[model samples]
Target: MGDELTEETGHEARAPAEGEADRRPGRRALLVGGAAAALGTVLLAREELSHLWWRLPGVDHAREDGAVDYRGAQWIAASSANLRRADRPDDYRIDRVVVHVTQGSYRSAVNVFQDSSHRAAAHYVVRRDGHVAQMIRELDVAFHAGNRQYNERSVGIEHEGFVEKASSFTDAMYASSARLTAAICARYGMPVDRTHVIGHAEVPGADHTDPGRHWDWDRYMKLVRRARTALA
Candidate 1:
């Protein structure tokens, strides 16, 4: 009769405090299991983690031009070899725009920026077709200007083609580059005049004259002012 009662109840007729069994893991075991699982996940996702790095507060990886403007231009981040990180508006004040002429095709310029050996790049590159590519973020300094002071306090824009080729400075290039410059000026509180917006030739100790005589300052400034108004 007692055996029949035990079979029906699934337990012996005894005090649970004295006879109960504890099969569950303790707190230390649970913590160890969780840590092991987390480690496994990290190891499994190493390939994905390797492709990403810490970017500045304003960096937009989804952007093709790497800027928030979302104009037709896209962003392609330059390698670390061509740029260095800096806290903009806090550590450095970008008060000027330095224009340059790439002498080579836009593709060639991008290739050079990607190469560690070249050790040079700009914040933005305006192509002959008026398409823009932002290689470096505005918050960081690009190795564009020959002078350290100019590089530290200015945003460098490279126009596709050589200083000697007046034909490369197309109407579309002027308008697009002007719009970009206006946007930069607006963001940085810089004036769109020639004093604040200058050529690579204007830099102190600069040996090269790019965006030289062929670059129409009056037309570019007019376009820049108009673009800034439109953007506002």
Candidate 2:
């Protein structure tokens, strides 16, 4: 049976005991497979292994707790269980910014992120009044996106309010979030565009329709571009 590796289920293939039958290849064997087919299999699924590196002890340098990436944002650490510590950009290059809308208020979103049981949190939360809160550090990976690859390669920003309520998207929120997204783009040398800056609904295999129909893409993108120019 092929070994299954997922964000939820991190099971690896175990080797047979010394004298046991070689029914399935172990983890070590898979890494250094001899046959061409085995090598091909390894190449196809190598990304699955990258996700586990952060779990290793001392893989990345220690970071100060509660350090905010955005200068003026408040620092509120997310649950350790809700985020994975990694040396990002060094390990997984960040290329996308995923926009999300919390189905509730700013405080509610922060509370849920602090709860380990939530199992999900974003790197930052932008409130309606343009207040920003940094939960997970930019150097780590948050379990915000349902898709594992997207989670690793993107920074998720959760905006306060429901997707259906257009009024929830305030002018203050847009300006502040645009600056934040622009900073992210500038930091990673990513272009401020639709493909790089996407909504949660755009994620592949995502069931959630967040930053939904009410989200004004043209307004948001224009604001992002203006903010990016200011930074440049």
Candidate 3:
């Protein structure tokens, strides 16, 4: 009845003359043209488009601000300035879990993450008493790892207490942290081993040593494997 306008050309598409085989584009044709236009736009704005995809509805819908990846972890929003927004396993493939030590109390770790000037934070913090607080979402990138590539590709978990204190690595802390790490590994389909589950010190170009010497890797790995098996 009325002339259809093609968005890209902004020109009126002529309607087929009466009984002249009505060659105006159908729904399928319109859809194809729209898709092509969108593709062209994406090509022109590729870099900025990368960060905007997750915001689109039904794509990778944004999770609630304080949503916790781990079921039992308490939700505590980290300063938005402290972390980088990203679409993980989409923009960045997360294959490792970087372990860190707060060198202070759990509450202090949370406070630090809430400070915009700190410019660093892990995804989760495990307290000495086995409590877990999730400050950053797994979908985003936290700045805990000093190295940029490592920070982009791994989830960071901080344990409460100083690196030099073996007593800080309590049984409760180990058990809870193992379960959390196992869950993360399972989520990302990562192997439950030292290669994938590594200390902050092991990160390439890391300046800080954490979950340090007294962390007892042998026992922790055993616990993680056991926890992973149980999850299966």
Candidate 4:
């Protein structure tokens, strides 16, 4: 009668096999591990997706054209035409600073940066009055250097006004730009020397002479050195 009742009760109440008891925890552990892995994968996917969304228009990041301005300078994004979006210090190293002259007023230079067809942009722009604007982020690449290799590894700073006009490179402009250059050198572990800090005219590929004759390297370097020491 008891056997009949056991049979009627079915296998739900049956004793587990000798080794099955030991494997119960293992099976549970496997399920937990799988769930954790799945969650991790989902989280990673979410992160990638979020970053991808940041590239699209309307997101609270760099504009559809450029990245947020470098180190909190006024955010004047050059848009998509001027800079290349990149993962910096990861894909490229910033080891040099390239100086440039806009050859135009600050307003005109800004307009050029915003224009898509111009295809030119610098990381920062120092106005004649010493006010600065950052059109691109330090983590990304700007298209100011004529040399691709240099462009990839250097930060370009464009000064408003023509190189021919020594007055355009005013004391305030020099002091401001020098401070920025020094800050960049300090951050990138670059030596504040003529070798690492050069004018656009010095780029290897060579047919431009911007920040030219009047761009006083001697005084500029002195200010840069002072700024570097102040930072320390």
The most accurate candidate by TM-score is: 2
Model 3 Cα RMSD, 1 decimal: 13.0
Residue 105's lDDT within candidate 2 is 94
Worst 10 residues of 4 by lDDT: 60-69
Per-residue lDDT of 204 in model 2: 98
lDDT (C-alpha) at residue 87 in model 2: 80
**Model 3, residue 181: displacement in angstroms?**
0.2
RMSD of each candidate relative to the true structure = 18.2, 11.1, 13.0, 14.7
Q: Tell me model 3's lDDT, rounded to 2 decimals.
A: 0.91
List the candidate numbers ranked by lDDT, top first. 2, 3, 4, 1
Give the poorly placed runs of model 2, Cα more than 4 Å off.
Answer: 1-37, 40-59
- lDDT value, candidate 1, whole model: 0.83
lDDT per model, in order? 0.83, 0.91, 0.91, 0.84
Model 2, position 132, has a per-residue lDDT of 98
Tell me the deviation in Å of residue 32 in model 4.
54
List TM-scores for all candidates, in order.
0.70, 0.79, 0.77, 0.70
**Candidate 1 residue lDDT tens string, 32-77:** 9999999999986884344233344554233333463436668887
Candidate 2 local lDDT, 131-159, one digit each (tens): 99999888888999899889989999999
Which one wins by TM-score: 2 or 4? 2
- Model 2: weakest 10-residue lDDT segment is 4-13
